[model samples]
Structures are given as structure tokens and as C-alpha cells.
Target: MANKLIKQMGLPKSIANIFTARNIITAKDALSHTEFELMELLDVDKEEVTSAMAHVSEVVCPPCQTALLLLEQRVRNETLAGHLPTHLKGLDEALCGGIPFGVLTELVGPAGIGKTQFCLKLSLLASLPASCGGLDGRVIYIDIESKFRSKRLIEIGINSFPEIFLKKGMAQEMAGRILVLRPTSLSEFAESLYQIKVSLLQQQVKLLIIDSMAALVLGEHECGTSRQQALGVHVSFIKSLAEFSRIPVILTNQVRSQFGDESRMYSFQEPLYNKR
Candidate 1:
């Protein structure tokens, strides 16, 4: 079956030279040229091809998947190796020696658990000078909950990367570059992210923050849909944005409460212990 597909695509048997033995027959080469050229070679609808790849790649040893995985890991490692230092001396060590780039890092917990404070401190640290422990990259704060406080940010910035705001003129300029977006609706929130992506591509921003995922989706709960569907859309949209922009997206999610009696706990425990 794989041989027939390869023959139909006009690919050569020498594909093995480019792919590993496990994946040589199970994948189509990604187009290296224009979209029209890709369409001509694949001879399939773009959406169909995307869906087919998503399904088949899960079950087969896909050449493209293997190659892409390696490429992503290589980029991640290189970025981590070259990452700038942070002011909080022990923070980097806590994170396995350095901040990672091109990958998402999730810091989750209940409210008032220092999630926002941690993000604020990290943003400031990200903007500091190399000598003073900073990455010198612009930060974009997406305040979906309207919780951003410029004064607080400045205070944290002063402590974490004081040199960045030492001069009035430089401070104002740096503040202007530290973009902030507080959207009132989901559409607006999503649009702001798209704008952020465009800005990043144009060298206007670097780091991104989406504080408290629950706040963004809580408004949608009034629509009365199933909880799973609501969460699915929210997660899917965020994932899509991350993949398309190839930027790190830090999204904080809320945990649901569990309520039951001691007997209920015992019932759950019994099932787990009985499994063995």
C-alpha cells in the first residue's frame, strides 16, 4: 500500500536516503516551493491532506513527523542554550539552568497563588540587561482579566531589572515597547493575539502572556453549552495560535473544585485498590 502511494506521487525509491527506515514509506514530503506547486504534487485538498496527515501520522511511522520533531527539538535546545540570564540568581537553576525558548511553560495553581506575581517578575527579568540578568526582549502582556497594573509592573521591573528603567527617557521608551492588551470580549481577545503575532514578526514584541485562562472562558459559560465543548474550543484556539506564530504562549487555567463525603472518597479508593 505504501509503495503504491509513493509510486503514484512520483517519488523515488531513493527517498530512504532522506528518511529513516521506519518512515520511508508512510509519509509525503512537505512542499518546499509555492503553494501551487505543493498542490500539484500532492493533488489533494489542503484541508483533507491536513486531516489525513493528523490521523495517519498517529498510526504510522511518518517521515515528516519524525523530521519535524527533530527540527523542533533542535531549535528548542539551541534557544535554551543561548537564553539570557535572569536577575533572581536561583531562578534559572530552579528551571533546569536556563529559561527555555520556543516551548510553553505552565505555572498553574489556585487564585492568589502567586501566578500573576511570578509572571510580572519574569516579564521584568526578561527585559533586563545581560550584565544585570535579563534577556533584553520585549514583553507583551495580554490582560484578559483587566488585572494589569503599570505601577506594580514598574515596581517589579525596578527590583528585577532596575537598569532597564533607571533613566526617565529610557523608562518611557521601554514601557511603550512593553505592549499591553486588555480585551473585553473573546473576539477582541483573539484579535489582539493575531495583532501580537504580526507585531512579533515585525520585531515589535518577543514574549507573550495570557493570564488566567478561566477568566477568558468564564463569560462563555453563560451560553449553556457542555463544559467539554467550551474547554475544547478555548484550548484549540490557544494551541492554534501557538503553532501558527511559533511563539511561546503561557496560559493559566483554573482548577475545578471537588466535593464529596468520606464514603465517596472510600468508594473511589476501593475501585483504584481493587484494580490490582
Candidate 2:
């Protein structure tokens, strides 16, 4: 009966036979083996590994194996998949026709550039009806520096969709769909990430906005530590989680003037983008 699950997944019979020969026990256990990892176990050549990968893709839905061809297909899928529109014509056009689902988009600028306002707008716009250009799904807003503005969210909602929210309690329902998190420091942000990993998927969070990604690491940089490297780890974790869950993460970052250069600026020493 366990073998039936493998067969139902559209994998070849020989692959199942190979697993049984190795005493792999069940398809669940066998599924964990990558094509490269399976070489020693199966005593197989590269061609056999390719064949195993093909079988693996049958059960994995999207293939776990990374190849140039697979990556091209993944990019194609991302472009074709439905995206969350920010509901502004020019901004949407600038953001590749709306924020692409399943990736991180960094909004970097100096102070007073409306990053928080944009985030608030996104949270409100994310919950509107599809006819009015919204995802109709919940949002996860991770605020740092005490900057998640609910009053602004309400104003944006009431202004953008007066007809919808005016119909009694719809405003609160819209507000309820936005799940807000205030993480004061780096450790708190990390803890919040763990708590939200499953919730994002289970609750169908369509958008994630991290206001001021640099806020948590500010103290570390002041103390002359490896704050850049540390920030990379944090951003990488958030990026992978966002990508894996197919949710678009909007991160707000603060810019710093390059030391001794006095001409150029960089975002968190380039670790946030370059390393990841």
C-alpha cells in the first residue's frame, strides 16, 4: 500500500524497485535523497541519477534538483504566476507589472520617502477585492522602530475603497486580515521569523512587509562588530522563507554614506543583496 503512493505520484516502477533493493523502507524516506546523494546508495552512473531526478520531480511537484534548465523554468513560472499589485498604476509598472510573487523586493531610500506609507498602503491594498486590484489575502507586517501605522491603514482603506468599507464592519474585517509584528531587536526578529514560518502558509498570507530591515542591526554596526555579515544571515533567512512560501516580501532599508568616500552610499555593506 505504501508503494501505491509512489506509483500514484507518477514515478517509474524501476525507481521503486531500486528503493526496495536498498531497504529504503518507504517512499517518504527515499524522497529525502537527492540525485547526487543517491549515487553511492544506488551505485549508479550520472545517467541513472538523471533518471532518479526525473522520478523525484514526479513526487516533489516542483523539482528539487537545480539545473540551468530547471532554473529557466522556475523564472518562467514566476513571471507567469499571478502577482500582487500595489494598486498604483506607475508604481505597479515600475515593479515589473506588480510585485512578483515569491521573491524579496527591497525599497531603499533616505528618510521621508514614504516607505512606511507605502507599507501601510500595501497592507490595506492587499485585502481589497480582486475587482479592485487586490490579493484578497492576509498580510504580515513586521515593524521595527515602532512604525506600523494603523491609522494610516484605515485612512488608505477608507479612501481607496470607500464603497466596500462603508458597508458596516468591513473596515475592521479588512484591518483584521493584516497580522502585525513588532520586533525590537535582531534576536526578537529572529524569534518572530520562527513563529511566523508556518503561520504564513497556514493563514494564506499573501504579502510580507518588513519595515526598516536595518533597524535591528543598528546597534551592532555602532559597536564595530560583524553586523553586515549578521544582517546577511537574517535577510537570507527571510528571503528563503518568503520564496519557499511563494510570498512577496517588501523590505525597507536605510542607506548609509560610505566612510572616507563621501560620494557613494551602500545598503548594509552590500551583504543583504550580494551574498544572498
Which candidate leads in TM-score? 2
Q: At residue 148, give the lDDT of candidate 1.
A: 75
TM-score of each: 0.61, 0.67
Clashing pairs in 2: none
What does the lDDT read for residue 73 in candidate 2? 67
Instruction: Compose the digit string of candidate 1's lDDT tens values, residues 1-276.
Output: 333343234334443222333233434443223445534455646664455444434434444557567756655563554543344468655444444454444555666777787777666666554465565667888788777787887777666555557766656655655677788877777677667767776763556777855566667564434544655665566556555555555665544443543221101011121110
Going through the candidates in order, what is the number of backbone clashes in each? 0, 0
Worst 10 residues of 1 by lDDT: 264-273
lDDT for position 272 in model 2: 41
RMSD of each: 11.9, 8.1
Q: What is the lDDT of residue 124 in candidate 2?
A: 78
Q: How do the residues 1-276 of candidate 2 rate in per-residue lDDT, one tens digit apiece?
A: 234344455556776577658876555666678767777787777787677666655655643566666656655666786567777788766555577677777887777888898888888777876676788889989888788778878888888778987889988989999988888778888999888898887998888888876767775476434776777888888888877888777888765555575633235323242111
Which residue window of length 10 is worst by lDDT in model 2?
Answer: 267-276
